[model samples]
Target chain A: MTTDDPSFSPPSFVPFERLCLIGLGLIGSSLGHATRRAGAAREIIGVDRHQPNGQKALEIGFIDTLAPDLETAVTGADLVILATPVGAFDAIGKAIGPHLSPGAIVSDVGSVKGVALDVLTPHLPAHIHLLPAHPVAGTENSGPEAGFASLFDGRWSILTPPEGSDPDALSRLTAFWEQLGATVEIMTAAHHDLVLAITSHIPHLIAYNIVGTAADLETVTKSEVIKFSAGGFRDFTRIAASDPDMWRDIFLSNKDAVLEMLGRFSEDLSVLQRAIRDGDGATLHDLFSRTRAIRREIIEAGQDAAAADFGRRPPSRADDSKF
Target chain B: MTTDDPSFSPPSFVPFERLCLIGLGLIGSSLGHATRRAGAAREIIGVDRHQPNGQKALEIGFIDTLAPDLETAVTGADLVILATPVGAFDAIGKAIGPHLSPGAIVSDVGSVKGVALDVLTPHLPAHIHLLPAHPVAGTENSGPEAGFASLFDGRWSILTPPEGSDPDALSRLTAFWEQLGATVEIMTAAHHDLVLAITSHIPHLIAYNIVGTAADLETVTKSEVIKFSAGGFRDFTRIAASDPDMWRDIFLSNKDAVLEMLGRFSEDLSVLQRAIRDGDGATLHDLFSRTRAIRREIIEAGQDAAAADFGRRPPSRADDSKF
Candidate 1:
């Protein structure tokens, strides 16, 4: 409580002379909104290869200034955020290398941090700080318009800093995100990539794969599958609806970790299959009982707002605004 | 088209002078709502061993009457609906056998219809009609109050009748479900059980297994799992939250078909796992692409309403009229 009082008393955030956000897609736009709302920067600017997205970010008040090109955006900007798909990071980094302000902090919101750091660092100037980040929160929706101020509220935003990093940049970035109502965790790039492989990347891949397979079945069979999706399949559809370019780059970049976790999941799944095949009701019952206990923990952790029982309604959409 | 008429005629719903529901759980309660909405029966009485459930159903207006004993509920009813746990069919069958009204059209909403027929038919009066059924729609919820008028709207209700079943009873039951906006499919009991085992039962069992593993991890690891469950884990929770007794009965009753489907699923999953471990991007891409196509067919079938994409709107508290 004593530490928190000073943290809130002054009501000020990390101050930056200039901030740049490259590629104003959903993540980029959200960064612009949070940075602007927190007063973390004197000026916030966004640049996108696509002319309309840059113009739209300006029109939507997500950024104070719009840069028509990459070099123009990073010039003299003290803090730069790259929010493009991972496949574009190397090129964007290379394009802005000569223009980055000396001692400027450069960060990204790519799903895979190891590949991102490896690709972006070689092309960047030595004087700049390159910190990789991934905010593990987003709806399946995409684009600049989908970004909202509260998108990161109560979520986790992980920062993967290279060894011997500048403490000033690290703490500043942490405070900036904390202002946006997100908890900040610091880890190494390699570990961040691995943790996310199980937590986010593999889950997304499995969902996409299942939805894709269901969509490909024989016409009659496919129809029945979708019709009865309420039976369980529809849950996969929302995740599958995620931005294709972002996911494609994620799978392409995080191949190793995702593959490893997928292997474990499959092995575990097979053991379950064997038990079911053997008419092992004891196994199924035991597992089902254990999983319900997890539901209780999730409820207790406030991750699941609803009570453990589905019989009780979750906080409903009395007002769509809550969503 | 000829079934439509210019005259103002109400829909033809099968009517029962007397109706009895043997269980008052989710499926049974939903059936009660459907019948009441269509005026399908003059007096609908419930027979659950838990007398509180019978009283609750009556209090909620989900049933027209309450019967403390099973014999009382079935003795004079023209239509008796067995909605007990699938594993309990034989015991229920024996208890109700001598009390079943002559020429009554008896049916069930058990997930495994073949087992139900085998267990119950020997005990039923030969003169009574036995038409087993499985409604392919449900929330991960249980009990009488979990039902609503729209529960079965646009869902499939499969009727699995044995050989030499009475045609008149078939037409009447079909008409009854159709009034609730469901399309009916008639299949042999064996085929129906196999279909459900693959499409529904196996998937549910897998969900239970995975969630259980996640739950049993270290407390820190498990909490992390829930917080980031926007990944695949949250989807599994909905399935795992299903009623314990009902799922237990399903696993025990449909042992054969569930095992067979589990075998095929395990083989398919292993192949995918190998592709992932081998970093076979092309294989992953192919399977994922195939699944997405299946989702397309499901959409085209008009079986899945688009609103389901957001997930039943989390139910409403403003509407507690059922209580």
Candidate 2:
């Protein structure tokens, strides 16, 4: 659907009467900017326990109004988003459930969907709708100030609606994302969690681990690590710079899946280490070749899939030259 | 130390009568091109065991002449650079030893200096001078065809010269790199190897290990690894994409230092893994905060140092938002 068509011109904005966004961190602030830009709501109010962050978000125009109390923010809101850290879900859900408007939809931007749904659903009001959502777009930078208006553009916004949900509301929510330049995808909460356990969750945990490992090398001077990082430590340093609280919650929430993946990664590493120890260059070469091919495949598929599209032309990994 | 006075520049256009480059890989080719562009060489000759790389270097204008035999390249050259893989230094030095010219300055671009000196010095003619060098700039990409003009811009090129070496030859080589837009630093061969083992060599080995580990995971599908790699794995892919031959030689030649560093790294990693298993959030947070401070320090130093200089900028760790 081209935006040039009169029908595709978004006839009119389907505005939520009141949208309560919890947390004033990077994701929440970006969502506040995105919703306002898409004109998806009449009033965008933010709820946070941190008084300074709530005040900062309002001052920076991330939200139209700031509410210090979570229950008060959800009192009459049509759409309530729990954008806090994944570990904070249960406490926030219990506090806001009783005050949610009838027929209002509650969603979240937590990374682990199955855990988020589990923590959120049991405490929610029976009259309200619980739709767990996760937008797979972020940087190491955090806080309200670190966010920008275009953070979600061309990225994946995964919605995991529980079975037997209202179809019309789902369609409306999907359309809302499409209008904001993000491609929306629907998946089961359990499947989404599993896929991300391999993709986003475990990778981040490993990155964090390696970075921690590099930081702990007391025998090697820190200056040396920074200087010749061109070899590989530079890459880990980037990941290690990720928002600490967000990643902390992710590992805590997806503990089982993360531990399982970590075990596999460790096993694979031991084999490679043994091959290197035994001077088996062929084994290392073969694995490197296979992984290089996989990198090429990813650059292609990511451009085709509406999810996490980097926009513009494809960046074939062919330009990757490791001297 | 600045190129501010164009009038006081070194004597212009002293083209070498004969210049021999032992390896036609990325660094050697870039030096060839820069030498040609600066009119510093009248005849640029390259030699490689594999005839194809030497031929490619000639075809790409990186070298004016090609030598299928190492002796043919070394016979009449005043400046002979052994730019082959570090592991191949012994074989190349033995092959070219008897053919060296009377006052030839034999230098190299190997990453590890101690190993290079160990292999090359014994085979060198007494009259021939040995100046071990390493250009600390490279991409993940390699080969003769991958060379570019600006690759050495703003990069550090360290020269590890032996005690009581010919001052005139050393001054000429330093002038050579300065003309190529690199800041030249002089240091001892052992110190250079130790510094690089911590910086370049260890980092490359770690990246290769982690990337190989992630790729060999049987439980997590390859497709999932590719999809979520935008989070942090992309950086690993870039680092892991470096030339296998170069890295293979790096580890083989610098075995002792790399093994020592690897021991340090593994010990540190075990401590971190224990902390994570014990759920020491405070410990994790403290480490994260310290790493952040280190990153800032590197940036500040680079920024401050390069403020007055023309081409010696910091590494690109700060460029990407994902990092």
Candidate 3:
């Protein structure tokens, strides 16, 4: 099913009779909204370590009910989605393992897939299926209030099922994401880790690092940086403002891939540094020009809006009310 | 003169009898629209080496008329603004020098102020005032058609006037930018370069470099990169898609400061890289959390709109026809 086709509906078969979401933050709450909108689940159960977030999710109408504990949440659920930071997967898997009903499908929306398999597989019961999924979409915002149903529209959702996984469970999860307005792809957990290392993890690391570097500069005060941020520094701040705990977990879990991509990035940056120091206009121009093409491809692929300024129009009357 | 006041009018003093804008691209054309909207200039003349751009600027009503050549553009103009790439300043200054009317105040909207002084000062006649300015605002879009009148609203316009320059001319230029809807500040050319190095130039360089690094990864194909960009890499792509020629000139012109800031960035990144390699979650979390505050400061200072997702709402019917 194509995500671009707004009229497309999920196959008549329901993926899960009862879906339990283990976290109620941005991704989890968004999933709840999408599934409820698509009628993809008969009942949606929300659980969060922070009780207030689960309450918020229930009040927001993304979930039909809120479970105070994992055992209660997963007791009769046919599908259990672990939607927290990657670092929490181990504990979550162990906690939900015994409570999960027989033949229940387990999935997650973590940024790193390889580590998800390593941490979750050992704890999960063999009778249940574990399909690791990464929905390549999000805003920097966090918590239930920050999520909207359309977050995954026209975005990719990659599912990485370990070898010897049940085919029926895998397709059911894929159908669930597609119904929620995402094009789905399947890949190995290892490859997903490497791809996201460069595309997501490393880019986030660089954004955080540069913002830190700019803030620490003795020559340019923090006020100056903020005042002049329209000159391009503000763009980095958006990505850097992402959930700190989530990113911290991603880096630690995907340590090897993150380090490899970081190494490549540093090497490439050093070359740029040298060119700048040596007054290499041609090198800078060529590199800058080539990167422009990638931006075009991304816009064409529908991964980004084609708007001139990332579609950041001046506030209208409605926007003022939001503030 | 508050930029936030949409109904603000320039304080009754017209800064220039006639304003000539050389190189009618994004910056130049935007200046034309702004000056015309604010009635800051009595007559605005557009000049571009690419004749179509001049014609487009006139058709768009951003300028009163189009001048066929640099000589004609500067002949009767009291204010001549060089809005070309910094690299072209030497040739432009030389071409327009002999024709510039005495007492004409010459200024530029180049990103690199120090180089603007170095390149344009030698070629211009001593009678004409050279007041270099950098308006710290723009989108990634280029060309005359991409210009908009409100681009400078709530943004900073930094002036880097040379020492011993006529105070009257400096103040006139400052008043012009202020009337065009920017808050004005004065600083040395050296200091401006250093400040922008961290805030604008280095951020752009890192953006360009990271996009390039992602595109060239052998394991991750370009298609995957594009598909998954929304995860984080797409933010960098917006900045990277900026006009290549302008960025090339900025890197070459502001080599010293860019290199220095880049050095600091590389060092900071190296430390982060080490932390990640050693699985240092605290460092990553601390840095990521600190940067979030900078984003807050920028939004509070009115440098960025506080709308979630950089104010990118899904296109309503009003935005459809914009394409």
| Candidate 2 lDDT tens digits, A159-225 | 8888888766676666766665565667788767766776676566655555555566655566555
Candidate 2 docks at the CAPRI level of incorrect
- Single out the weakest 10-residue window by summed lDDT for candidate 1 chain B: B314-323
Ranking by DockQ: 3, 1, 2
Instruction: List candidate 2 stretches off by more than 4 Å.
Output: A1-15, A163-165, A210-219, A302-323, B1-17, B162-164, B303-323
Ordered list by lDDT, greatest first = 3, 1, 2
Candidate number achieving the greatest TM-score relative to the actual structure: 3
Total backbone collisions for each predicted model: 14, 9, 0
**CAPRI band for model 1:** acceptable
Worst 10 residues of 3 chain B by lDDT: B314-323
- lDDT string, candidate 1, B1-323, tens digits: 01122552334555888889999988788888888887878888887888778878988888878887888889899989998888778888898899988999888888788898899889998899999977777877778878776676666788877888877787787777777656667778887776676567766776776666555444226656765665456767777877777787787788787766665655566666676566565766666555545544444454343332233232232221211
What would the per-residue lDDT of candidate 3 be over residues A1-323, giving only the tens digit for each residue? 32333654555556579999999999999999999888889999989999899889988999998998999999999899999999898899889888889999999999999988989889888799999999988888899998888887766788888998876787688888878987777789999999999889988998999899999989888887877887888889988999999999999999899888888888898888888778888998999989999988776665557776635544232322222
The A-chain TM-scores of all the candidates are: 0.89, 0.88, 0.92
Better of 1 and 3 by TM-score: 3
- Report the C-alpha lDDT of model 3 over B74-153, residue by residue, as the tens digit: 99899999999998999999999999989999999999999999998998888999999999988888999989998887
Q: List model 2 lDDT by residue over B1-323, tens digit each.
A: 12222553344435567789988888888889878777776788898877888878878988888887888888899889887778788998899899999888899988888887888999998999898888777766678877776555555678888888876677677777767766566777877776677666666665566566666666556655664555556555666667777777776667677666666655655555565666666666666665555545434434112111111121122222221
